[model samples]
Target chain A: MIVARIIDSIWATRKAEELNGFKFVLGEELTSEGNGKRRIVAVDIVGAGIGDRVIITTGSSGRKMLGDENIPVDAVVVGIVDDDCNFK
Target chain B: MIVARIIDSIWATRKAEELNGFKFVLGEELTSEGNGKRRIVAVDIVGAGIGDRVIITTGSSGRKMLGDENIPVDAVVVGIVDDDCNFK
Candidate 1:
């Protein structure tokens, strides 16, 4: 899992059929220093909003999180962070 | 999926039991410009060697490639690149 911040929502008119009805969000990875690193698009499973610190699960775990292995998604927002002592 | 070059092999005396007998390699992501970027440690499933440009699969796909869902591995070398017109 990686810590990230939801930066924005994304919409695509044309995409894989398996990806339909899934909410996508742009997330920036957060370092322990609170710096943002690589940006990724992930399925928003936890209803995270922009500015929300989130926990992301990547790869097949995304499918596992949704209980479906055919979603063609590689990343997913699994949790919203309430507080973290490691980073502000 | 991502493109990377295997830079070095790794050995660990202690690791997760599920990871035993797996070959680990340090891989550096390759840009279209052929420059190296982020580095990652991945299980080498394709017998890739140091200096080999390889295709890597992350997350549960690594487990899928190995035909096991409980390997606890995140990244894997899925293929070795032979010729690429995109990068030199």
Candidate 2:
């Protein structure tokens, strides 16, 4: 999982069926060696909030978080990182 | 999932318990709009080879590929691309 900071919460009045109860967060990926300019939207199943450093899962495994491979989601927040962990 | 090219295979004689019997491959993520310079390590369950473009799932969702969410892996190869895919 890559380290990322939640930038904001995303709201979609109309979305796919499986995403109904899931919280979505906008985030910018973080890397220890270089700039992490890639922005992505991820489902927050771990209660991550804005400014929280989180571990995100992407792709089919991301879809699998909701128990289905057909879920439209490509990213999901699986863990919130503690300040003490050295990301490097 | 992100599209990436398998750069080479990875070998670890000693590894985490959940990672045993798994094939590890090194890869570079691909993007249609810009340079794909991000390098990553991924588990290959789909038979992707060196130089083959493949789809990868990352993070906790990535760990879920083995049916258990406790796997030590962070990325996984889920698909191989053909020549016809319009990645854009």
C-alpha local distance difference test of each model: 0.70, 0.71
List the lowest-lDDT window of 10 residues for candidate 2 chain A: A79-88
By DockQ, the best candidate is: 2
Model 2: pairs clashing at backbone N, Cα or C within 3 Å: none
Cα-based RMSD of candidate 1:
9.0
Candidate 2 wrong stretches, greater than 4 Å: B1-88
For candidate 2, the per-residue lDDT at A30 reads 65
Residue range A1-88, candidate 2, lDDT tens digits: 4557899998998987877888889988764346756888988876777998776656655565466666688777766665554423
Runs in model 1 deviating more than 4 A are: A1-88, B33-36, B84-88
Candidate 1 C-alpha lDDT tens digits along A1-88: 8888877665544334455688777677788665435665677877898899999888775667676664445777889988564554
